[model samples]
Target: MYAQPQPQTTGRYIDLFPYIPWLLTGGMVFALIFGALWERTMVSTNLLVNPDTAAELKPIQLKKEPIGALRIDVNASISYNQWVTYEIQVKDQQGKVLASGIKQAWAESGTWVEEGESGTWAENDLMGGLDVRANQSEPVIIAIDVLEYSDTAGKEIDKPVSFQVIVKNGVVDDRYLWTGLFGTLLLSVLALFTVSSTGKVVINKSNPDSDVVARAICGNKDRLIRVVVKVQSDEYSPSSLHIRLTVNDANGEQLYSQTHLVNVKRSKSDGKVTSGSSALTTFFVLEPRGSYGFHAEVTPDASVDRTRIIVRENARTLFPVKVVTLKSSDAQ
Candidate 1:
């Protein structure tokens, strides 16, 4: 007698439904970290800049690209009729030169121009230069390739080799200081702001980043500040934009003040106001680590005639930040 067909036993399997979202989230996080690491291994850049020299080195990635490339940029203030040359070399940890080339200076302009690759270096005469009065600092770029690959320990590797940039026969421009001095005096009179204590000093305790557009307004010989005024409509139908700027010193002395008027444009068909932006630049001799304050008054005119005045709002001030000089040593 078949003692009742033996009861079938089945094992339960784990379901992934509840854990799928968490697993996917963890996988995405892992992928992001891995992608960042892989990208870092592909390409890298080093920059060095100072009053005398500015240099940058960029190594190209060859993992996906068939041909490897290295780009170098050098900025130097060469005086009129002065000439300089540069040299690049790739050395292993033991200081073995794997590749060597000389920077070519151009003749007609006396600066390097984009000419196709000629071996590792360019023609000899292309490296010379004479700085123009208006444009003193000349920019030079050198692009090379991985002649051979090797590790820092001297073992053969399939990656781009690392190198150092050395400047030879280079001189610091003597006229640089003079240029800065003249520039500061000119910008102080034109674009700088000077506000009186009577107007307003709205200190921004927490400087929240605002959406404003600013471009190079003006400069003292070497330093400049950009200004952008955001005018919220004071009147329902403002016809124009008026901005007043004031610059104050540490002791609260007003150094400068200026008023700017921007005419509003309207569409002929519907008379709708068109949006616009205004920017101003000022250059001056700014002391390092010094705090400067900028205050602005924005008004929207609602007059039907261009000459009439419109309602105005209280002035606004941006949080003051110290001016810090940027150095090549700061770059990684």
Candidate 2:
């Protein structure tokens, strides 16, 4: 018999259906991440007041200067408990009402209603933002002016708002705060370095005498403040180092300078290289409304043990000497 025909072998191919679920899950994860980043959140970014209210309350009206009408744009929405009569009042310096009435304020739906997100305010779209500058340029008799607020029943809010306005006399921009923070960091780092390497340094208020002195004065038309520092060394000793201080107001166009010379003379002791003393005094000239801080740098003659002291009127903080030595190999 011819070779018996072997039974035809049959094989089944398994479908890749199981992997579809895994591929789908991976795609979903990536999609979610992309969607989160792509989503846009539009709101009144320069929100001066914290609208993240804790409870049944509106944003806190922070104390700030009224830049006439030029500084602000207003959008408002209101709901009223009931139709109630409200009054407007602007006060004088003597706390007397200069004007009071229901002054007509042009109101409309803000153009920024893009899905409850605060849209950008355009110059032309400045709604109902009555130019308070015309009446606001000079000190007013009206105790208050409703520049703009969320309304209650188509009427101005009569609710007693706990708000006050405080104006900054000079420019205190982001740079100022950043630099201040940086300076503070530098001081802290230096302080730590000194402690780790040498020992403790202290800051103390200086007693004014022949060796130590302090003086301060305001400068410029805008009352820009500057400092002048002077230190005169006497007795022709090696420890005597004269210090000159100069301060200039960086607040405005006009720069003013004030200076004071203080003497840093040798003490009445052995004129040893390491046996000497130093003192520092600071002067501050503050306007009726202004904020300021001191910036100080010190230079010593040769390699004397100089004191890094921060002195105020009644308090002083001292930083230690940080000697950074270099090894010959490291230098190479």
Candidate 3:
């Protein structure tokens, strides 16, 4: 009777209930970050124009051999806009403007659509015109006749001549202008609302640390598009990370694929894996002028959840590929 038990303390349980709101708030914040990352910083990329600059020149050897021409493919990727303009210029190594008569630009009508996005095209709208729309790309053939060459010094012209292709002008429809805003919001939501996941892969235009974008590679047929895939692993895990990647064409034909592994090191004090990262680089060849499908698949170790992987494609988790051709009149 003297050892009666005191009332059990309920304060411990009450204190945890207050933290319930905090825990819920923290969870909501993390979910928003995850959503943004999954969306790839808003799915909004840039309107890219390839071969920002080009230059090549040689001396004429023979009159009958015909004047050589500088053939360059001017390509504009309309990812966020509907239309843009490309201005082509031919110049000597001296920076003097060459005559337009030596330059010729031709494009096949109804040959393309926006590079990454989808849309309908009419016969009148082709790569030939100055007004370029989303997903459309064409080659501009600049033929500089070496046979008619007249050097200023009357000597062998042995200088590196240059040809310039630029995205001199761009105009977007008012309706589609919202893409910029929407894209920003999408990214903002990603940054503010979602938490980054471990064991994730991010595809960027040129480098792993750069902004992720679907790029348009133009110019030479053998030109290569370098893509960087960045992967991450848990800081506290005990095991190393292994990531396998596969690339395929739109027809489901395999193009290129490989697997990468990252080793984890732990601190002596923490005895944890410590955060780890691995960057992988792969190249894709640009094909002749025609839209083609291409994508990449990433598979992490069984221990890492599949949902933790971040990729460009939302549902299929594959990257898309498109090819455009650049050729001279003779070659075309």
Report the lDDT tens digits of candidate 2 across residue range 1-332: 22211222211211233334445445555544543454322212221222222111122222234321211223322232322222234344555654444423333333576666776442222122212224323453322244434343455444432222222121223344355445555555554343222211122223222223222222112221212233323343354444433222224211122233334455553744323444444323233332222333334444333333332221112322111111111111
State candidate 3's TM-score: 0.24
Candidate 3 lDDT over 1-332, as tens digits, reads 12211222122111122334445555555555543343211111222223223322332111111212122333332222122223434443455544332222222224355768666543212132222222322233232222221232333333322222222222222223344445545555543322222112233333232122232223235443334455443454434554454443334444344455655343343654545555554333334432333233334433321112223311110123332222222223
Give me the candidate number with maximum TM-score: 3
What's the C-alpha lDDT at position 85 in model 1?
41
- Model 1 spans > 4 angstroms off: 1-221, 232-239, 265-269, 274-285, 300-332
Question: What stretches of model 3 exceed 4 Å from their correct place?
Answer: 1-220, 236-240, 262-269, 289-332
Q: Against the correct fold, how does model 2 do in TM-score?
A: 0.20
Query: How should the candidates be ordered by TM-score, best one leading?
Result: 3, 1, 2
Against the reference, the lDDT scores of all candidates come to 0.33, 0.31, 0.33
The TM-scores of all predictions, comma-separated, are 0.23, 0.20, 0.24
lDDT of 1 by residue, 183-289 (tens): 54444433223221112222322111222211111222233232334433322434565656555444444554556676544333355444433333222233332
C-alpha-based local distance difference test score of model 3: 0.33
Model 2 scores worst on lDDT over the 10 consecutive residues at 323-332
- Model 2: how far is 83 from its true place, Å? 99
